[model samples]
Each structure stands twice: as structure tokens, then as C-alpha cells.
Target: MTSMRTLPQSSPTDETPLVALRNLRVGMPAPDGGAPVIVLDGVDLTIAKGEIVGLVGESGSGKSMMALSMIGLVPPPVRVLSGSIKLEGRELIGLPERQWRSTRGGTVGMVFQDPMTGLNPVRSVGALLTESVRRHQRVDNRRALEIAEKALLAVGVPAARERLSAYPHQLSGGLRQRVMIALALVNDPKVIIADEPTTALDATIQAQILDLLRDRLHAAGGLMITHDLGVAADICDRIAVIYHGRIVEEGPTADVLRRPRHPYTAGLLAAVPHFGSRGSRLEPIPGQPPGPTRERAACSFQPRCKHARQACALAPALVASGPERRVACHNPIEEAAR
Candidate 1:
């Protein structure tokens, strides 16, 4: 298990975060079940108003579980042990299910990666959209349809009024993805949690979806979960690099991307195929992250990090490095930009 000294508390920012979590921990059933596996360990993050913060990591890094935890959607056998999850100063950690339902579609919304699984196969798109608005707004059928139409039109869904009558199967992949986004926006939520939204779409459609979320929707704040460093750079104002249930590094997107202090973040950026570096082979991170049940008091990435040292035996807490920058590493890289 990892152990770290508590970080110093900073002066409160001028604006409070729209969504905030401090010392949050979550547990799930382990593969070789003797005890519950720790999925997230003392994770802290915040999304400020009117900004997009991307959570980037490789698959199976608990990024998606963290997303689910934010909105209180963590399923059975996966439960929060302790800590605070606050939205706009309201405590969400122990809120009852009834209260959470109101907060879900009304204040916070989720857009899953795959539209097919998210949408019902038997229902018409209109029925789905109409029901979403009615569930949260409690409006009549006619009013609900009107809200859905406006939401679809606002997201640039072509023939918004006509497409409402079509079912999920009838639409193209791109249009279906747009429909899912429209579904998330039907209630005009303040915080949108999009989990790997671009993974299933083509490059052209992915650009469109990102633009819609960045420019149109998410005026308050947003949490975008993505594996692509390039996508994080494109839309995220700030980026958090998560690995093995902890944040390795976080800062303004430019700062983290240009001068990654943590080796994991640097490795992720290195794997990306830069436009100017076409001739070189794509560099991938050498090893896998520790499993859910596995925990290390020392650096878990010691095996993979080329920069590891004897001092790395001690666990490192996420410490402030520069303006709006934090890294959890003993041997942080010093790049020219810094």
C-alpha cells in the first residue's frame, strides 16, 4: 500500500471549484478475493467553472471508476469508504438516493462512450429525449418534446425536429454520438462528465463532438475522461494525469504537456505521434500499471521509470511545483520550459 505525508493546504482560490473531491477513496472486489481491492486511493481533484479539465490515463487505470464516483454512480460491490465530494459547496458524499436523482440529470450529467449501450434499442429517439426532459423537468409530453428539439438543434443535430422521430438504429454512428451528447444536454446541466466520448468515433466526428462540448455546452465546467494526450491538449484548459489510483501530475494543459514533471505523463506524451516527428517510431510506455488489488508503498512505477533512484523507496505526495502545477514524484524532470 502507498503511504504519503499530507500536502500543505494552499490559500483558497478566488473562485471555488464547481466540483471538488478531497481524500476520496473507493473500493471494489478483488480478483483473488481475500479483501476488497482499492480502486481509488486518497484522490483529490477539482474542476473550476467555465473550464474543461481532462483526466488522461491508460485503460484499466480507474479513470472511469473515478468518473462514476463523481456523480455517485458507482455500482454494487464498489463503494466509497471515506472523504468528501462536494458540488458547488453542497455535500454529495452521503446524500440519499432520492436526492441524488434530482442532482443527477438536473445539476450533473453523464455521456457514456458508446451510444448503442447507452440508448435503448426499442425506443425511438424522440421517446428517449422526451423522457429525459420529463424525468428531470416534470413537464408534459408536449413541453418535453419541445425541450428535446431545442437541445438537439443547439448541438447542431441536422433536421432536429424530424430526427427525433427516428430510432437509434436508424442514425449513422456520428449522428448517434451527437444524439447522446444532446441527451446529456437536455436538462442543461452545470457539470458534464463525458467518459471517453471520442474513443468510438471517427477523427472528423470526434472533432465536431469536442467542439460542441468546448464551445457550446459545458459553459459552467466539464470533466473529460480521455486516453489521448492529443485530445486532452486540444480541448482541456487543464489536465490531470492519473495512474494507479493517484494523480501523478496536474497543471495547465500547456505546462503539463510541454514540461511534464512526472515520468508517466512524459511517457504518455512521448507515445503520441507528433506531426513533425513522422520518421521516428512511436514510443510506448514500457510496462503496465499495478493491478487494482496491488499496491506499493514505494513507487509502483519504479520498474518502468528510467529515472528511478534509491530515494524512490519513499512514497511521494503530490507537491506544488509551480503556478497551478503539482507532481507526485521524488525525481521530477526539469525541462527547458520550466
Candidate 2:
């Protein structure tokens, strides 16, 4: 079994990864008597302390599943079958639900993709924020309310005191998202998992929310799951490109964006528009992601890769190619000689 191994004793620095997922595999039982359905396959990722790690991929690429697994929020029909999720020297995977519940919001907070689904429509924003504060801190309603309002203000919501009394629907999409962020940060978690936090807002609003999150959460690290490479480039220190539930490449955001090493990663970057690009005609990756039910052996992306060779028939493990980059491909992209 692939195991999560830490580098022999290293001090905490801007360089050391704060959270690490090693050889992670999340799978579920197949409905028609077949091999287990693999949603996340032998994935490995690292996020430095106080750094932003962006996980990017097309739809159904298991970006959200990976995020949910980190915080023990994987819904039914999916389970973490193996691997270790280490956060600040503690293993999170395989921990009992009770233990995870105790540590989740306090140690690791999460801001889901859709604020509407995450927030309680029946309750006012104030009630929801207060509840989050009360759950983690030993404080009365008065103190919790104070903390809740402070959280709102921290996320840039004006008149936080008044906004707390309003229902989720009363706020704009951007405001509701800010409230979501406030709830995530109420307990001052060490790591925050934001899954497409800006999906529902306008481009300008999205930029604002991303900026706020990047600024306010600079002290604590973050893992942002997004399909937009532009967003990732704007906010993340490093980028991990996931294709068909597996990470094909990972490196500094600038490195990966400028010189993608995996075919899948290259295809994704090519599909994005550039400043000098001709028209708005976007070039999407051809073919759909493999079905979750399919049993995968060889490289899952071999069928779609333009550079697939005989060696690709055997799955490639993520291998270190440089001090800060890794690629899982038999035919890796050649780095330009300086």
C-alpha cells in the first residue's frame, strides 16, 4: 500500500507544506459486481503553511471529492478507502466521525461551492453564525454574537450587526458568500478548504471575494478548489492539476501555468484564453471524463493524450523532477534550458 511519509524532521517555514495527502484513494463499491469505483486514485498533494494551494480540473474531475475527503465530509456512496491526510502532524483519514466532528470546524474549516445549500434557509444569518461560534468556543450567546459580528466585518460585509439579522436570501450572492467565509473562519481554523467559492457571483464580485479571502486568510493557509486557471493563478502559490480523479501534475503556479508537464495539464492550459488570443472561441478538451464505474488500470488519460506511448499502458507514479515540481507521465514535458 502507498503510504504517507514525511521528510525527516523539518522546521515549519514558508517552504514546508502544512497539510499533505499521500497516495490517497477514495473509492466506493460498484453497483454491478465489479472492482470498486475509484474516484480519487493514489493522489498526493502538499500545501505549505500560510500558502494557497489551488486544485484545478474540469467538471467531474473529483476536485470537490478530494476537498470533502480532507475534512471527513465525503457523502454516502463514496468512502476514503486508503491513504493518509496529515494536517500539522496529525492523521485525519480513518478517524472516527465523532473525532472528526470535534476537529473539523476548529482545526479545518470548509466553505462549500454553493452558499445556498450550505446556509440554513430557515435560520437568519445571525443565528447560523452564532451557532458556529458556540459550537467551537466556550462562550455565551452574547460573546458568540460579538464574535459572529466580528467575523462578518472581517469578511468585508458592511454593517455586520444589521446584516446578521437578515436571512440568507436578503443578502446578495456576494454577501451570502462572505457570510459563508465568516462561518468558516469563526473558530480561526489552521486550514480552510474553499470549493469554488466564487462560482455564483459576477466576475467583478468574484475578483473581490477572492481578494478578500487571499488577504484576510493570509495568516492561515488555504486550499482552493477551482476549474478556473485564472483564479488559481491569481490566488494560489502552487497548482495541482487533477484529471479523471488523479493528479497529473503539481508545481509552483507560475511553473505549471507557463510550462505544463502533463498532457492533460497542457490541454487544460491551452484551452484557456490568453491576452493576445484571437477570438472568444474556447477550445475544450475533447472526450468526456471516464465513468466512475469503469475500472482503470493504465493511465486514465492515455486515451485522451496526444503523446501516449507504450509505456503509458502502465500507470505512472508521481515522481519528483525538480525541487518544487512533480509530474506523473511517461513522456513528461521537457523544461526549457535556461
Candidate 3:
């Protein structure tokens, strides 16, 4: 087994990782009389102050689930059975809904994947933004409106003053996303959870949105949930590759992309288009992700792993092997393999 890297732990007073989760397990009731489904199992993650951590994996890999769990937003049927979610060292797991309501959008903001779902179609962008500011701060309508306009302009929305009156349906997709970001940042949250913020947008617009988010949140530090390895490499200071509810490989973005230790991580990187690539076909990881109904007693990737062995039956924990790298594979890919 290769040794993993050990990075410096942020100081307790840093106020970074305004939000964090450790050993989180989200479960759902089973249809029949059996154990509840485990959507997330033993997940440990951290987002430091002024740092961006990308959670990358295929769909249903529990990336979004992890984000939702942090803010107490897991949808119906799925419940957080056990875990420790802390925001600035304050526990958030068992907090009541009222407390969560007070904390969410106030201290910790979130940006969803779809603007239409996140924004209110009936409400004008200005009203939504102003409401968010008013909800958290003890400000009157005039001050809230001023803060809203400033936030909209801060997000690069042109003529923010006039655009504030426009409803979400009247704006372009890119503009709507900008509004979503404006709303998320209006309260000056210490942390932001952006789940697939670039989904469904064209490459050009996607790049623009990503750039805006990266630049705007550069100092606040947050967690970005995404499936695009390219985006992860571009924006995240570090990347963690999740597979079947557990992180398989995690390290500095440059290190992970250049030398993926886990097979799944390698496959994801290989799938990204490279400049001047010659006849290199994108390789997809064969086999479907394990369904919620499936039992997870052993390694989740064993069935699709090329190096699986009898030892895979015993699940491997994420172990450090470098200054800033960790992998859970019994047989990790070496740097020379790629």
C-alpha cells in the first residue's frame, strides 16, 4: 500500500470550512420490511476558508446528496440517520427545522443546478434578492433593495437597476443563473454550496458562469459539486472522486488529474477531451452505478474494477498515501500506468 499525503489542517480560528460533514450517512425507508437504503455512507469531507473543493463523480454517486445533507435539504424519504455536519465548528446534524431555516441562506448559502427550479418564476429577480437580504439582516426595504442591486451588479448583471424588475422568465438562461448567484451571495454567506451550477448551459456560457463564480467566491471558499472533471480541474483547488457513496480518490487537482490513483478517477479523466488528441476514444466506465436497493457490504467498484480481487470483499477505507492524496482502492493505479 502506498503512503498517502498529509496536508496541513486549517487552524481552528480560520473560520474556513464554514460548512463541513464527517461520517455522514443518509438513509431512506425500504419498500419492504428491510433495512433502509443508504444513500450516503461514512462520507468525510471538508471545505476550507478561501479554498474550493470539488466533488466529482458520475450521476447517483451521492455528490448532490452530500451537499443536500450538509444544509438539511435532503428530499423526502431520505433522512440523515447519523453524521456530524458542522459550520464553523457548530454542529448542524440534529438542529431543528426552524434553526436550519435561520441558518440556511443566512450563514451558508446554496446555488442549485437549475435556475428555473431555484428561482421563483412568479417573483421578480429584485424581489427575491431583496427578500433574501431582508430575511437575514435587520434592514428595511430601501436598504435591502440597495443591497440587492449591488449584489446583482456584483455578479456582472448588466444594468442591474433596471433588470431587477424583470421576472425570471424574461431573462436569458445565463442571466437567470446570474440572478441565482446574486441571490446566494446577497447575504454575504461565509460558505456556498454550488451543485452543478453549469449544467444545461452551452460551453461558452458555462465557461462564463464558472468564471464568474470562481472570481466572485475566490475569497469566501466553498464546495462545488460537479460531474465534469474539466470544470473540477479548472476551478477546484482540490478534487475528491466519489464512487458508490464513498470517495475513491482525493488530492490536489493537478496531482489527481496528472496521476489518478484510482481506476474510476483515471476513467473520468480519460473521458475528458484533450487538445490535439489523436484517435483517443473517450472511455466510459462500463456497468451502471449500484442502485440504492443493492447491499454495500464490500467495495462498490469491485464489480467494474479491472484489478478487483478477493480482498475487495472487505471494503477499503480512504487512506493517505502522500502529502495530499488519499485513495480507497486495494489496487490503485500507479503514475506510470497512465
Top candidate on TM-score is: 3
lDDT of 3 by residue, 1-338 (tens): 12211323333455435566788888897779588888888888887887899999889999999988877899988889797887876788899899998788887888889986778879998899988898899999999999999999999999999998999998888999999998889998888889999996778989999998897667687889999988998899999999888889999999999988898888788778888997989887788888764488899998888888899998899999688999998889876665
**Top lDDT model:** 2
Rank list by lDDT: 2, 3, 1
Per-residue CA lDDT of model 2 for 39-151, tens digit only, reads: 99888998778889999988888999999999998887888989988887577888887989877888888888787677889899999989878888999999999999999
Model 1 regions lying over 4 Å from their true place: 1-14, 29-35, 336-338
- The positional error of residue 86 in candidate 3, measured at the CA in angstroms, is 0.8
Q: Estimate the TM-score of every prediction.
A: 0.92, 0.92, 0.93
Cα lDDT listed for each candidate: 0.85, 0.86, 0.86
List ranges where model 3 is wrong by over 4 Å.
Answer: 1-12, 15-17, 31-33
Q: Global lDDT for candidate 3? A: 0.86
